[model samples]
Target chain A: MRLLKIIIKNYKLLDDNFSLEFIPKGRKNIEDKEFELNQIDDNLYTFATMAVIGKNASGKTTTLEALAIAYDILSNFKIKHSLNEIKNNNKTISLELYFYYNKYLYYYKTDLGYEPINDFVSFKNEELYNCFYYKSYSNDIFNLDKYSKIINNTVLPDDTSIIYTILNKITMRGLYYWSDFELSYDIDKIIEIYKTLDTNMLSVVVNLLDEHIKDIKRENNNKFMILYNDNTQEVKTKKELFSMLSSGTTKGLFLYIQIITAMLSGADVLVDEIEIHFQRTLIDNIINLFKDKSINKYHSTLIFSTHYPELLDLTSRTDNIIICKQNKKRIIVENMYDYNLRSDSIKSKKLYENYFNTAINYETLMNLKKELMQEIK
Target chain B: MKYLIMCEGPNEKAVVNLLLDNNLLIFNRNDLLGLDIYHARQLVPYLVNLINSYNCSNLKIIRIGDKFTDKLKIPESIKHIIDYKQILKCHTHPELEILLIIDKNLFDKFNKEKSKIKAKDFAKKHISLNGHLYDNTTQFWNDYFKNNIKNLVNDIKKCKKIGKNKKEEIYLADLLKK
Candidate 1:
C-alpha cells in the first residue's frame, strides 16, 4: 500500500491542474533504482520521501493541505465543506489519487462543483468518482462482483467512497498530517501503542529533544507524561516541556513521535511547513530518516512541503523533487529531473539554485526596486 | 556505437553538435550525448564513473577541447584516475577516445613550421586533433556545419573569417529537429 501520485485541480492555490508523481521515471541515471516497499514485492520503485519546494505564497502549504483534503475525505473526517470553497468561483474541484493497494493500482477521483442557484455545494448531489466505475447511496453500480471477495455482502453508507471501502479491506493506511505543538487528546491510546514500539523509537525522540527528556512513561494517575531530567525544573504539562525546547527541537520531537507511530501503523504522512525553525543539518537528518530505504522498514511514505533548499542536497533520486512555481494565477508543478536530465550526480542544492537562477525570472523584484528609486528621485 | 562528447564548455558542445548535424562525424544524433564540464581536472574521474555505470552495450566517449595546445598539458590529476595508460588495454567496452577540435590560431601558437608535425604527433599519441573549429561562435558553427567540413586542418585553413569572438550557443529549436 503506497501512494504513487496525486493530481489536484481547481482547489485554492492549486488552480488549473497540479500533479505530483511519487515514483522516479526511467532516464540515463537515478532512474532504474527501485525502492523495495516492505519486501511485500521486490522491484517496487516508489519514493519513500517526497519533498515539495516553492517560493513564499507559491502554494507549497496549500499543496500539502489539498492532499489532507483527499485523506480527510477518504477517512470520512468531517469538514465544514465537502471541499474548500473557491472565492466567488464555480470551477469544479477534483482530486485524483493513485495508490497501490494490495498489489493493485487504484485511481480514485472525487469532484465537487458549486451550485450557484442553490447557493451551496453538496456532496450528495454532486457526481463522485466520475470514472469508469461508481457507487451511490450505499449501492455499487458497477464492478460490484469484482469487490465481492473483500466486501463480503457488506453495504457501506452512501457517503462512504469506494476508496474508503477498499482501504478498509486491506492494510492500506490513510495519510496523517502533523504540525508544531500538536497535542493529541487521546494520549492514553498513543501510550499503549508506543509501549509496543521498540526502545530505539523512544530514544530517537528523546535524543532529538536536546536530551532533556529521559524517558516517556505512564504516571500514577494513568496519564502519559514525559519524564525529564531533574536538572530541569519540574514541568506540570506537556506544553511546559514543549516551551522549554527550541522551536526546531520541539518540532523534531513532535514529528518523530508522529513518524514512529505512523511507521508502526504503516501509514503515509503529509507535513506542511516541515522546515519551519529547523537548521539545515537537522532538516537533512529528519529527511534522511524517511529517505533512507533501509531504516524505512514499513515503507511508510513522507510527503512534506519545505522552504529549505538545503534539504534538496539530501535527496539521492531526482524524481523525489517536486518544484511548484506560480505562473500568474495558476500553479505549475514540475519534476526537477526533467529540467536538468544530467547523468552526473549533481548536488540537489546546486540544481535547485540553478533552476531558480536560470529557469525563474526575478524581473518583478528588480522593477519594483527601480520604481522605488525613481520615486525617491 | 553510443557517443558521449565530453567537453570543457558550451562552445565545444556547439561544435560537436554542428559536426554531428552535418554528418561529418561517424555518429548520429541518437548515438551522441553532450556534457558541458566546468572543471577540467574532474573530467576523467567523471568519465570513468559514467562509463562504468553506463548500461549500454556500445558506448564510446570523445574528449573535445578548445585548442590543440590545451592537450599538451594532460595533468597528473586526470592521469591518476582510471589509469589513462590502461585505456588501450581495456577493449571489452567501447574505448575512451579523444578528439581535440580547436581554432587555427592555435596552430600559429604551436609555431606554423612545426604545426603539422606537432598535430600528427598529437594524433599518433592519442593526445589531440580530429577536428579544427574556427573560433567560438554560432555563425562559425553554422557556416562550418552548412559547408560540411570533414577534414580538420583543411577546414581551419578555409573558414578563417568565422565570426566576432563570443560564447557559442546551440540553437535548441533547430537541434530538436530529428
Candidate 2:
C-alpha cells in the first residue's frame, strides 16, 4: 500500500485544514522510475522519497509524528498506542487519508475525540470510500456520488480504527517509522532485527562510517562481535558496543539496516532527523539507495526530516520537499513544488538564504550575541 | 482575487508599504498575493509557481518600477494559467528618485538640469531632512515620508502630469484611492 495524500486538522501544532500531498501535483519533471512509482495507474505516480525541513521547534518532528500516527492508524488499526505518545489539549482531531491498496484508491476520514480525564481516544465519526484510481483522479474524490461509500458512521471500538474493519480480512503492507528519540530504546530491537537480515550491507555501512571497524558480526542471540582493525571485542550489551564504536557507526548501522530491510520487503520507512550522527555523504548514499531502481525494486518510500538544507539538493523534484514554518502558533506545511523553483535550481541555497522564511532569525542571533558579550564584560 | 505588487527595488517597496500602511492605496495588505511586495524585475519561476499554486482564478500582477522599457513576460509554464492582460505596470520613471526630488520641491529645478544631472544624483545633492542628506535607502525614504505622507501622495499625483504619456503608461498615483 502507498500513501497518496493526507489532510489533518486539529492535530497537535499543525494548522487547521493542513494538507500534504505525496504525489506530483501538476507537471512531472523527472521521469525516473525509481524517483516515483506507477503502481496504481500509468498516469498516476507516487513519490519514493519525501523530506520535511524547517527551523528548530518549527514542528518538523510534529509533522513526522502526525504522519506516524496516521500510518499507525491505517496499518495497526489501533490509535490507543499512538495517542499516548502525543500530548495535545485539543479535544478532537480529524484526519482524511488517501492510500492505494489492491489497485483501488481508499479514502478514509475519521474524527477522533480525546477524553483528558479518561486518557482515551474515541472515534466520533468515520467514513470510508473505495474508488477507482482513474475516476477519482479525474473528478473530485470527495464527491460521494462518484465513489462507493463502503463504510459510513460505522460503530467500532473506541481505540480501534474504522480501517480495521475493512482491511482486517486482507493482509496489508507494512510501514516502518523511526523517531529521532527512539535510538536508545531501539538499539536492542535493531540488533535483533538485524540478526535476521544479511550482514554484508551492515559491514559495508559500518566501514563507510568508521574506519576503525573492520566488521560487525552477531555471534548469537545476545552478543555482538566487533572486529576492529587493531583488535576485536565481544560485547553483550549495546551500551558496551556503543562505547567501542563511533556514534556515527552505530546510528548508521541502525539506519542502513532498516533501509535495507524495508527495501527487501517493500515497506515504507519514515525517519526523523535523518542527518543526525551521519556525514553528508552517508546521508546522500542512503537517499541514493532508495533512488536506485536496481536495488529498490519494490519502490519502497523513504520519508525523513533533516536540519541540514544541503541534503535537499539530493531530491530531483520540488514536490518531494516539504517546508514547515511556524505562523501564529500553528505549523504551516508547504510543498516546494508550489514554490515554482526550476528543476535545476539549488534548493539548499534558497533555503539557506531564507527565501522561504524557514531559516533562523538574524535579529535573535544578534540579541544572543549581545547578551553573551554583556555577560563576558 | 490576488494582487502581486512587484517593486523594482527596496526604495519602491518602502513607498508601497507607506501607502499600504496609511490606507492610501486601493488594495490593502489582505488583498496581496503573498502578503508582501515583490522586487523581481521579471516574473520569476518561484513567483509564478506561487501564483499557480493558488486555487484562485482571479490574480492580477502589478509591477511598480522606475522603468517599463522591458516588457513583463510571464514564463511559459504559467502562461496558460495567467494571461498577459492580468499584468499591470505602474512606472515611477524617469526614476524612483523622482519621488525624492518631487518631495523636496526641486522637480522644476531638476527638470531644467535633467539633461545634465540624473534625478538620483540630483536627489542625493539636494534632498535632505534635518541636516541628514538623502542616501536612497529604504529606511531614509520611510523616515522622510512617515509624517509627510499627504505630500508624498500629492507629489506622486503632480509627477503623473510631467513628461509621461498617460495613454501608454500607468503611474504610482494611479494605484492610490481617490
Candidate 3:
C-alpha cells in the first residue's frame, strides 16, 4: 500500500488543516520521471522518498512523529500509545489519510478525542471510503459522496482504529519508525533482529563508516567480536560493542539494516533526525538505496526529517520535499512544489537563503547574545 | 481578493508600506499577500504557489519597480494556473528617489542638472529629515515620510511628467484611492 496524502488537524504543533501530499501536482516534468516515483496506476505516482526539512525547533520532528502515529494507527489497529503521547489539553485530533491498496483508493477519516473524565483517549468518529483507482480520476477520487462508503460511524473498540481493523483482515504491511531517543533503547533489540537476518550488508555498512573495523561477528551469547585492520580482535557485549564503535558507525549500521529490511518488505520507513551522526555522502547513499528501483524492488518509501538542507538537493521533484515552518506556535507544512522556483535553481541554496521563510531568526540570536552578555557581566 | 505587491528594492518597499500605513492605496494591508522585493521574473513560482495555496480567484500582482522592460514570462508549468491579465506594473520612472527630490521641492533644481547628477545623488545631498541627511536607506525614507505622508502623496502626483513616455507603464499615483 502506498500513502498518497494525509490531512492532520489540531495534532501536536501542526496548524489546523495541515495537509501533506505524496503525489506530484501541477505540470509534470519529464525529467522527474528519472526520480524514484512509484507508479501506482496509469499516470498516477507516489514518491519513493520524502524529505522533511526546516530550521531548529521548526517542527520537522513533530511532522515525522505525526506521520509515525498516523501509520501506526492505520496498520496496527491501535491508538493507545498515541493517546498516551498527548500531553496537551486538546479535546480531539482529526486525521484524513488517503492510500492506495489493491487497485483501490481508500480514504480513511477519524477523530481521536481525549476523555478527560476517564483520563483516556479514543476514536470519537470514523468514516471510510473506497474509490476505484483510475488515471483519469486524479483528485476526483477525493469526492466522498461519489464513492462507496464501506464504513461510517460504526461502533468499534475505543482504542482500535476502524480502518486498521478492516484492512488487517486482508493484510497490512507494517511501517518502521525510528527517532533519536528510540535508538539507544532499541539498540539491543535491533541487534537481535539483525542477528536473525543477513549480516553481510551490516558488515559492509560498518566498514564503510569506520574503515578501522575489518570485520564484525555476532557470537552465540549476544556478544560481538570486532576485528581491527591490525589483526586485533576483542569480544564485547552489545552495549560495549556499540559504545566501542563511533556513534556514526553504529547509527549507519542500524539505518542500513532497517532500510534493507523495509525494502525487502515494501514497508514505509519513517526516521527523524536522519542526518545525525552521519556524513553527507552516507546519507546520500541511503537515500539512493530507496531511489534505485533494482535495489528497492518492493517500492518501499523512505520518509525522513533532516536539518541539512543540502540533502534535499538529491530529490528531483519538489513534491517530495516537505518544508516545515513554525510561526506563533503553529506548525505550517508546505510542499516544496508550492514555492515558485526556477527549474535550474539549487534547492539547498534557496533554503539556505530563506526563500521559504524557514531560516532562523536573527532577532532571536541577538536576544540570546544579549542575555549571554548580561549573564557574563 | 488577494494582492501581491512586488517592490523593486527596499526603497520601493518602504514607499508601499508608507502608503499602506496611511491608507492611501485602494487595497488595505489585509488584502496584501506580502510586500516582497523579488523581481517579477524570479517571483513566478512563489506567486503560482501562493495562488494555489490560497485558492485565490481574484488575485492581482502589482509590480512596483523602476524598470518594467523585463517582462514576466510565465513558464508552461504555471501558465494555465495564472492569467497574464492579472499582472500590473507601477513604474517609478528614472528612480524611486525622485519622490525624495520632489518632497524636498528640488525637482526643478534636480531636473536642470538631471544630466549631471542622478536623483538619488541629488537627494542625498539636499534632502534631510529633522537635520539628518538622507542615507539612501529604506529606514531613512520611511522615517522621512513618516509624518509627511500628505507631502509624499503630493510629490508622487507632481512627478507625472516623469511617466510621460508611452511605455504602457502605470504610475504610483494610480494606486491611490480615488
State the lDDT of candidate 1 residue by residue for A38-80, as single tens digits. 3223344556677888787677777777666665655552222
TM-score of chain B of 2: 0.92
Q: What is the lDDT of residue A186 in candidate 3?
A: 67
Per-candidate TM-score against the hidden true structure: 0.53, 0.62, 0.63
Model 2 has a DockQ score of 0.01
Q: What is the lDDT of candidate 1?
A: 0.50
Badly placed stretches (over 4 Å) of model 3 are: A80-83, A87-89, A114-121, A151-156, A169-179, A182-184, A370-377, B1-178
Model 2, span B12-109: residue lDDT tens: 88899999999999899889875667666666433554565564658888888877656776655467777567788788888888988877778889
Residue-level lDDT tens digits of model 2 in A1-377: 77778888888779986888777765653233324443346556767778999999998888877787777776678664477654464547888988777667788888877767767777666778888767436334344465688844666767777787666742224444454446678787777778788778777777777887778787776567888878866555556776676666767777777788778877777888887777665666677667655577776778899888767766557888888999999999988888898766778889988888897889999999999999999
Cα lDDT tens digits for candidate 3, B86-140: 8887888778899888777788898899899987888888988889888888889
Better of 1 and 2 by lDDT: 2
Tell me how far the alpha carbon of residue A103 in candidate 1 is from the true structure, in angstroms, after superposition: 2.4
